[model samples]
Target chain A: MQLSPSLTQLIEALRCQPGIGPKSAQRIAFHLLERDRQGGKQLGQALTKAMTVVGHCQSCRTFTEQAQCDICASTKRQDSGLLCVVESPTDVLAIEQTGQYQGVYFVLMGHLSPIDGIGPKEIGLDILENKLQQGGINEVILATNPSVEGETTAHFIAELCHKYQVNASRIAHGIPVGGELDLVDGMTLMHAFTGRRTVSQL
Target chain B: MQLSPSLTQLIEALRCQPGIGPKSAQRIAFHLLERDRQGGKQLGQALTKAMTVVGHCQSCRTFTEQAQCDICASTKRQDSGLLCVVESPTDVLAIEQTGQYQGVYFVLMGHLSPIDGIGPKEIGLDILENKLQQGGINEVILATNPSVEGETTAHFIAELCHKYQVNASRIAHGIPVGGELDLVDGMTLMHAFTGRRTVSQL
Candidate 1:
């Protein structure tokens, strides 16, 4: 189309975003040029700044500009003696939304997958072990997903927690709160039955 | 979630894009940080450069770093004297993709919408009038959309063409080639009937 060099470059660069294809990249480029130059400027400045300065939080392995994330820096959260292990930073955000948990978090950033060359060390289990060895946490909640990889990762971490004499418990997995029984899959239904709890003592 | 300041700002800035909601913004931010920092950096640089340097082409009003767009700068296209008037630069791209048109373009950048206070000057009709007055263009093809606003804008331009003794023609409207009769809307069917052309003189 003989598009301007800068316009073409902008479209090409927009393709870097996940789920954005060629058509979407073109649309986004045109939209920015036509409707929102200011927004384009702001996004550019933000991206440049973030990519240059933002780094992993040393304490929790989540994204942060500081040495430790806000939650990891809070003395009260650290003093709670409860650490939740998760697969990614997004999981921490989801759990925070629930507002029930009072603890710090350790983000694996990925699961333990040998085929992908990811192991305990890859998911920062070494850092987790170091934290546990310091003898502050009383319990470690395994909030990884219920997938096979998540289960294996949780089990491996559980073994490590046992070695440190810290209590390790897997988060419950079953049908969700409002899920229908018939619509639920066989594996989930089995897990629901296997993990059934008494509603009334009588 | 007590997200890091840069991460939070990146998410907020991402919302400036079209069709990106909160979840999509968060997902895009995380995806870039986790896997495509290089891409994010390139996108940032591209966006910044494009926003700063890309101005409207002096001749056609399409985005360009140069004074004239590549198409406008081409001697053959300029000499063809067949000007395609369209609502926006995207329309120019669509036409160029067809590989049929061999002409220059004049981008309105938007269709006429009187209630929105957009008049002739706003859509650069004054510039178009100046071009027509200079007297070299032979045909002005109105390739605006088939919407009411598009039609109104084309009609207004058509009247302007008559003042300068330039022939103006609107692009065809009717059922698409692969479209089904049953699936076609009444207005389009009516257009098909009204625009019907004879195939043979049998």
Candidate 2:
């Protein structure tokens, strides 16, 4: 069936979202035009404003309206000598939600994917290296995902920390806190067994 | 963690889409600002344009950029005297996709939900009554859904047709074409049995 030109354009534009398909795009377009034009206008204005004002934080590569993010600018965080590196801004939010980490963060934006031509520079690793080489950091934590590319990226960052003479640590890999052992995947089971610690350490 | 003001607004606006929640909205907002700013701008423009241009079709109440929709304006559709009444523009699209029906359509936009303060006038039943009373119509097909509200709406429309002395027919209720008998819901099974017809009728 033929749609109006503006409707077609709206559907096509909506397809740029991560999980949205043509069907979903069409549904969203119709919904906006039919039921929620005011909401649609609000969303459009918000998008324009965000695109205009939000940019990568100069210090940590997280999204921010200013040069440095709130976390990077704050003096209240206790562990100023420790840095936690992650693959994305979303990961930073996830870690922060725990309320246990007092250190600052470095966002890589993406993992190292050689097949996709994403190298160290593409993910802001050079900036991280520069931060480490400035000589005040005591420890570096690798908090990338458990994927192969994440592992490669973490190893590369670990080597950089070693060269800078800073201690390096990887986030533990095992069954999640609420997960059943029988349901845990084989790779995670093996990692858990190998990374097991004494009761005193716990 | 606290997000920038514009970033927060963008995330809130993204929740206007059908299934998106807080986490999905955040992900979509970040994706637009970080990776697909150009696409986001295009979407914003499309939304603005669509909102400015599109309005309800005069004859059928479907979304259109003009006074009449493409289907309503077309001369090739055979059944001008047959009106298929349905509950939303999306349902009109669903029926049109079958490529079987050549009749004109009347979009109710909603069902008769008195509890929600939606009565006959709210769903354009008055306009439908006027169309039926004008006397060219040979048949009115009740193509509303099979739920209780849908049935109530369909029956109401059928009564309107009877008042105008125009023929009224209900869309058949039965097992879906590819559905397994054992897997069909009890309500649908009862509807199928009750709606059964002779082979010669087919």
Candidate 3:
């Protein structure tokens, strides 16, 4: 039961990672010491550097070391006059991987969770409203997740777009391509049916 | 896309932990940035401290920040003259949890792993043999895992124990106490049958 003091602290600190529990924390600590000390050192340095340097982008609220994020600083993306709003920086990565959208992004950092005290101001909705009022954006695409909070957030932003007289559209909700319909949940199936389009005409 | 440099480095560095993949790395990074900045900072500091300071106990080869581990440093455990051989420090923790043994430990750090270029010297068998030759230990319990490599390593060490004229024993391998009979594997069942003793006499 009496492990080394620093090893115990390592285990305790490793539990801070999402989904990592006590057993996993211990396992990770032992593994790093036994097999990957160099990597462990590098990870420690990276964490310290990132925690100190990484900050929210002034224009989009995505993580960046500079005042403005790379996407926001790009003239090409800014010239497009299109802004796709998402819930987190990872969503920006997910959308960027597709190479489909040429627009810049607005990251909310989180969805509105009223019970948790998250509201228009908490998720940077006030920043978003200011951007909308400035009037360079031609359209705002609500690409938040399909959860209930995401939907509510999209609706709220859509109303904001209406107030600014800018166009707004929600991303489609339906069965994913190449997935079997039988395995799909009822809520998703319902969304697929309700959001049907005139595909043949298009 | 172009993620922030520090954020990207943090995600890449997080991959060093066992079982964490790209998506998990990104999720952890975002979770830390958005929710647990304080925990992330603490983990960073802890990792740096542990990786630099923790070393193997000289007496038992388990992790410690000093010359010997807590159990190995204790006079009572040293007087017991019982040394338990195991594959890793975690195994030491596991055995200590049972509270059925009052012995010091000799951690092998790994099993035989010959295909991976591991040998007797690599797992600190040289150190173990030296301890056996020192003439204080009365019994050495081979508590390595039941896998093929562990068995091979145990057999190899049993020979070393024989040369030193030290008493050696292997821990019991059988169906777990709370496990159902139908769920026990064939190999474990065979071990149970082969190692069965007269319960009334025991």
Question: In candidate 3, residue B25 scores what lDDT?
Answer: 87
Question: Which of the numbered candidates is closest to the native, going by highest DockQ?
Answer: 1
Best by TM-score: 1
Off by over 4 Å in 1: none
**iRMSD for every model:** 1.2, 1.2, 1.0
lDDT score for residue A42 of model 2: 87
Q: How do all models score by TM-score?
A: 0.95, 0.92, 0.91
Query: Which ranking of candidates, highest TM-score first?
Result: 1, 2, 3
> How does candidate 3 score on lDDT?
0.91
Worst 10 residues of 1 chain B by lDDT: B15-24
How many angstroms is the interface RMSD of candidate 3? 1.0
lDDT of 2: 0.88
Residue A83 in model 3: shift from native, Å?
1.0
Off by over 4 Å in 2: none
Question: Residue by residue across A116-158, what tens digits does model 3's lDDT show?
Answer: 9999999999999999999899999999999999999999999
Q: Per-residue lDDT for B56 in model 3? A: 89
